[model samples]
Target: MATDSPHPTRKALRRNVLALLAVLAALLATLVSVSSASAAPTPTIVLVHGAFADSTGWDGVATRLSSKGYPVQRFDNPLRGPAHDSALLEKKLAAIDGPIVLVGHSYGGMVITNVDDPDVVANVYIAAFAPAQGEFVQGLLNPIVYPGSRLLPPALQVKVVDDPTGVAGRNLDGYIARPYFREVFAQDVSVATAADMFAHQKSAALVANLEPSGPASWTRVPSWYLVSGQDRVIPPALQRFMASRVAPGHTSEVGASHVSMVSHPAAVTAVIEKAATA
Candidate 1:
């Protein structure tokens, strides 16, 4: 009898509950749509490794970037010559759909500088070699530039001689033959990791190529330079000189070896993050 007396009231309460749930569902859908629209697009980081090395050199750095929700790609340049390498890098840059940040380590720095892509928002130099107009790698390196260099283990020196390309020869087996890669390439890396790098290395002909970088993109694009104070490969002085030429909006120095990206990823990433946002 009581139920019969409250039948209409019960129906009304059920209707209210259903209506409330429908409203909630609609609100949730709206929220999802808004979130989708507001989410920031992930930045693309194209890593170009310097001579006598391949894409694997960027492994740890790539992993760190990926963890932070950034999409990363590594280029395997033929390393035949500067013109050829620059063309390859430009091809990769053309494929990117949106904003991009180009990172060059060691000789990779030179490669990025030669890439004539206008879409590149920022260039990040990580203890990388940045040459000036009409300058080549050889032009920037001299015995005085590298002092107290211990990263070039004797084993690596031997390998360079054995390498048929002459640029790396057998030395490609030891580590990066370039003074910069030897001194700073693994500054932040462990002995084990550095040794491992030596175990699997590729000889690059481009190292010996004296061809000048025709035109540098750094002249037009905003840039950042991360100088490794303890770098032995390219020399701290050369880094300073090159940085001054680029006139990057931001410049920082880290107590790392030439390969700061491998040794101090956090520091390298911090600079990259700034470049990406800028």
Candidate 2:
């Protein structure tokens, strides 16, 4: 201003260059962030436990999946009837931020079969039920129809309990008799571990097995099945029948008991990861 100094003009040019550089840096950062986010966003894995078991049964599988960078959640299945249990699961699925790889074990399969969430990218059944609309889990337990099932009579126990929710009026809870727990549920696992599982077992409402399934998501969603060759609770033959209904070429067999996730966690985890990547 005193005499139109070139030095002042030079200082103004430097400031403009610095500001422009800052703007470009910000844009570059945003683009890189977007690209990185789109390139490798891992899907969340939700593991649902079946009757006579709780979420802890998924500990081994969940840990393996988590180590591979997939987020894992072991859903605490209500053990209530399918309609009520599915409603609760659907609500939880809605809150998740990204795609989900849903894995179900035993009766947990029936629960996932009823969920219609769009976020559920794939369904992986681990020696689990995959019922059709109007079909009930109890139907699959028929020894005449799906022979080799050992979850009946002397191997099982049913207790009449007062329903607090009044959904079942008088709830009938089904449990795998203590002595038969290992044989009927998890023969592949260690005897001590099976005993531990028996101690923490959660009974499923009898209505859960008898109640007819509503809309089945397996009809629409992509599915993968792991047939437990030695499964006593659901029977291998029944597993094959259900797996056949799924889109062909997505089924695998494991020589495991009904609690495959506990005894063969790696094999079960592999199926889940396959579904996730697909």
Candidate 3:
């Protein structure tokens, strides 16, 4: 007979169910907070390789950056000309949603320098050319000014093959010495890696579309420059001059060759990490 009056008990049961759901909601919110805390930060790095090289040249650097929890993409630059490459790089930079660290190697430096992307938080030049206003890549090279320069390889002259589309070319070795290649391209690389690089070397077309850069990107964006002490290609002095032009406070020197990113990845990665955080 007493069980017939179930209103109070049923109300209590509804309260219990509501309390249980409230507890579950709190637990779910806590779980979400924990998941958010444990989730890795999204880091985007765009690597632009230099002359006579493809996107694969950044394989070593990409691995190091990825190991540090960065999402990295290496742009396979046409190596055609500065204007064309810069346009391509700008398009790539536009596609990235978050802030990005633009790392340029050798001539790729010029490409990053010209890309006018606001999302680009930092520009990292790894033993690469950092051109300033009214400068061309050709101007960066000394005019056979030093004996050491003479020892380095001569610049390759790229010409398009006879095709209706006027694309493709024959890559003739441009008087580059094996020792010079070994020193500049494979200084930190193993003998085998160096050999492989040489075998895969592509002919980079002279940037005929290159014009005097009007305004410098380093001026607006923070920059980090990695100087290769033994860089025979651009000359260490040139790197210093370029770094100074930007007035980058975060300047570093590694006792490696022009391709130090491949040889001394740890050092290069340190600079990139710094740039990303900065």
- lDDT values for all models: 0.74, 0.88, 0.76
Q: For candidate 2, write residues 14-42 as lDDT tens digits.
A: 99999999999999999999999779668
Model 1: per-residue Cα lDDT over 79-129, one tens digit each: 655677788889888888877899988778878888888778889887777
lDDT of 3 by residue, 123-172 (tens): 99998877777788776676554223322324333344332223453322
User: Each prediction's Cα RMSD?
Assistant: 8.0, 7.4, 7.4
Better of 1 and 2 by lDDT: 2
Residue pairs with backbone overlap in model 3: none
* Clashing pairs counted in every model: 14, 0, 0
Q: Per lDDT, what order, best first?
A: 2, 3, 1
lDDT winner among the candidates? 2
State, as a TM-score between 0 and 1, how close model 3 is to the true structure. Answer: 0.76
Candidate closest to the true structure, highest TM-score: 2
TM-score of 2: 0.85
